[model samples]
Target: MALKLRLKPCERVVINGCVVQNENRRYTLTISNFAQIIRGSDILQEEDAVTPVRRAYFLIQSMLLDPTIAANGSGAAAEMMAQLYTTFTRPDIQDRIARAMGHIGERDYYKALSALRPVMEYEGTLLSPAPSASAPSFQTEGLDLHAGHHAGG
Candidate 1:
């Protein structure tokens, strides 16, 4: 589905020039390809960024297969990219990714992100908000913070 993606350690990439069905078979093929990429690339040797990436991809695949993620309209897709962010080239890549994920359960995001940065950039779309979800909520009304109530007591 031609996705834009960002990976850890610094780089950008696109994914799926080839057609991919939203089925287990397709996902399995994708993961298998990913595994091969891992085997081929020397991502692991560079700054401790392999284990987490592999785990994150596993989690992403799991999320994509979930009906809830699919029903929510690209929740799975966002999560998938977010997972990749965990594997930054820098050491704190994991922490940053975890914070970005927020309430989402921990799944070694940092490690995974570091490892998959290349893959995401190569094969997926950049991370973006899900299609179905609304924008983040704001507490104050529009352009009237002092109008409705006194500021400074």
Candidate 2:
């Protein structure tokens, strides 16, 4: 099956380890073969990786975007994963982390990235300090702390 992508004007995407930028107009692309592809919006910069999970994600993203580092083995990725396992004692999160590692081992970078997203979410809840008892309950939606951006700010 082909993966079809409709990109906005000036949008960028990494396809099979190559960075491609759209020109003046919106464009559509059909990837007929297997390829590692990620949009610019989803690309997490290394400097933005603040938490342990985010750091692990950045390492995996780097492996996906740059084939050379992946070929050499991602020692940093393994180390980060180990640290995350030690830090987060939740069984479910640990299982997801293990699955992410399996995906990475199988060279399925996209799947690995997907698995890490939920792990990050769970980690956020665990690491966040509890609100005061008198304070009103608040929800954290569309809030990406690692991105250093607050929702509706």
Candidate 3:
């Protein structure tokens, strides 16, 4: 007697306006201005309210796990490196990944450590990914809270 196995087709992922299609759904592509969506999907199994700190932690972890990020020679040691780079360089994204990091660190050391490992590894490289033609331009002319809110969000 003989047995047969079956397989299903893979779904394509559209991220940061780039569509990466592959038969294997193992790899993740990290792009600017869209990490949140990817991270949220990857980290959250079900939809529910999550604190920014928790979201930030999960987001950084997801980025670190991405093959693209790991291939850049930035290993597990630099999980939150992606977020730190974005915070200082862009400083305009609606997400407060940096502030969330601080809050998590203040309240939970383990969570903070998990988030900071990446940042510590590539301190020098802690600059945001440069704006590409594909990226949207900054909107905040002023640095006030209201202005920052508009630009950041």
Candidate 4:
């Protein structure tokens, strides 16, 4: 099967562990054969992987991006799965995590990431502060926002 990819100007994509970037124009990429492709825009930067799910995501993404990463990250994959289990206790969430892990076990990195997306969204909602009218906002009348900093440089 042929996979046709339409890319915008300055877009970047990693194909079979090599990075290819379009310069200053729109273009279409055709993969006539099987290939591992990850778009630059879809990539999650390592530093941005702050949450447990994101950390797991980064691990899987790295494995997909590079074979060396895949070789070195097996233990990390197990640890990340365990962490996900500990963090998300809901049966439904756990099921999704297991599904992704199953894909991981099959070395289907792309599918694993796809399966993990909802868990990531759930984690985002869990971590984000949702403000309500009746919810108590902390009183900062006498609080210092920069308590640890000194006036002098």
Best by TM-score: 4
How does model 2 fare in lDDT? 0.85
> Candidate 3: minimum summed lDDT over ten consecutive residues — where?
33-42
Residue-level lDDT tens digits of model 1 in 1-153:
432222333232222222222322212222423211222132233333235444445444333334354245345535654655644544455544554355234332234444445554443333443566667777885677666577574
As for candidate 3, its clashing pairs are 77-117, 78-118, 79-118, 93-152, 94-152, 94-153
**1-153, model 2: which lDDT tens digit per residue?**
998989999999999888999998989999999888888988888888898898888888888888997886567777777788777788989888888888888888878888899998887887899888798876779866567465676
- Cα deviation of 36, candidate 4, in Å: 2.2
Error of 3 at 68 (Å): 28
RMSD (CA, Å), each prediction: 18.3, 10.2, 18.1, 3.4
Better of 3 and 4 by TM-score: 4
The global C-alpha lDDT for each of the candidates, from Candidate 1 onward, is 0.40, 0.85, 0.39, 0.88
For residues 92-120, write the lDDT of model 4, one tens digit per residue: 99998998889788888877888888999
Please estimate how well model 1 matches the true structure, expressed as its whole-model Cα lDDT. Answer: 0.40
What is the RMSD of candidate 1?
Answer: 18.3
**Looking at candidate 4, what is the lDDT of residue 61?**
94
Backbone clash count, each prediction separately: 19, 0, 6, 0
lDDT of 1 at 92: 54
